[model samples]
Target: MMISAATPFTLLGQNLLLLPQKAIFWEQQKALIIADVHFGKVGHFRKAGIAVPRDMEQSDLATLSDLISEYRPEKLLFLGDLFHSDMNNDWDWFILWRSQFPSLQIILIRGNHDIIADSHYQKLNIELYDELLIGPFLMLHHPLPDIQLQHASGYVFCGHIHPGVSLSGRGRQSITLPCFAFSSKQAVLPSFGKFTGKVAIRSRLTDKIFAVLKDKVIAID
Candidate 1:
């Protein structure tokens, strides 16, 4: 008999389920939220004669498969940059992935890098949105400015920054790794892409941050 993998914790009045990979599942919303997958990026790099690893794309998809099998989320929300560049052979792999999870709704909040033809997404049946409202949250690919905070209406969930924290020691230094950074008005997620880079972020005194570590997510005060 096979045992089901249980979802993870609840945070900030939301059910934050941490899968084995870096993806997060929101139980109440029945959505799996991931960021900056940059699928087909390796192909893009190689097309330009850059020596990036070839297996990165396949490995990325495999991780998605694992998460899907484990949580069975009704929808998969890509925060941004689903594909790195224009469509390529690697895109068919994504099309095949869409077929594998036919019943699973795929929504791409169009990020800056999503320059593929609209017809292609239409063929794949993936919904495109500049921003979305689900419950009390406004889902977007990029974060809003501080000036907009005064007029903000709801909690914002966004990606694109690929937020990480720096953790250093006497002789060893390793970043706190990718994280789900939360504040009063917004929450920023780590990039879902394996080949993407991370940026260190500074949290405010009133902010609540969750640093995603190797095994679990740790709360930082």
Candidate 2:
């Protein structure tokens, strides 16, 4: 499988590629940054007798494999919510996926929904952190509050809330799309999981907002 072309932009002096797959690739660091994957979400729903398709987990894994093959990133960073719930059968799929890229460094910044045991992640060789500072960005799961942003030393890359933007069309019709919300202090990535919901965000006039369409990412102007 081939990945669609990613939109390239410069943020905080770093080159970033916003892929149509709802992920960001940091060219300088060779890192692929994604958020809110909620890996076990389907299983979580099915466990409750919701009757989701069994292949949903496999699809997500295949997408990840395609992205890894396309970008060849040395590191894969999950901003947060790497897993949807507690241990489930879906975790086995993730473990198998990880095995394919044993040399790829995987990092997870703890998020609100990440409740799995540390031992489980450790066994898979995934490094866990509450928050991480690398280069010019501070990677985190939740966005920093206004007060905290004022005192921060570097730009922040975060997820959670599954940020999106509303685009008004002709007449009264309008559509909402997942987006990359970039303010001066921080940037919120779109949710990488197909099953997640998106929350339209409020952005300043000067903020850069890129909406993810079916096969591409476009600026909101």
Top lDDT hit:
2
lDDT by residue (tens digit), candidate 2, 44-93: 99989998889977887899899999999999999999999798999989
Model 2, position 81, has a per-residue lDDT of: 95
Candidate 1 lDDT, 9-102, residue by residue in tens = 6566778776435677899978899989999899988998999888889888988887788777899999879998788889988888888887
lDDT of 2: 0.92
Clashing residue pairs in candidate 1, if any? none
In terms of TM-score, the best-performing candidate is 2
Positional deviation of 80 in candidate 1, in angstroms?
Answer: 1.4
How does candidate 1 score on lDDT?
0.82
TM-score each candidate: 0.91, 0.98
The C-alpha lDDT values of all candidates are 0.82, 0.92
**Which window of 10 residues has the lowest lDDT sum in candidate 2?**
3-12
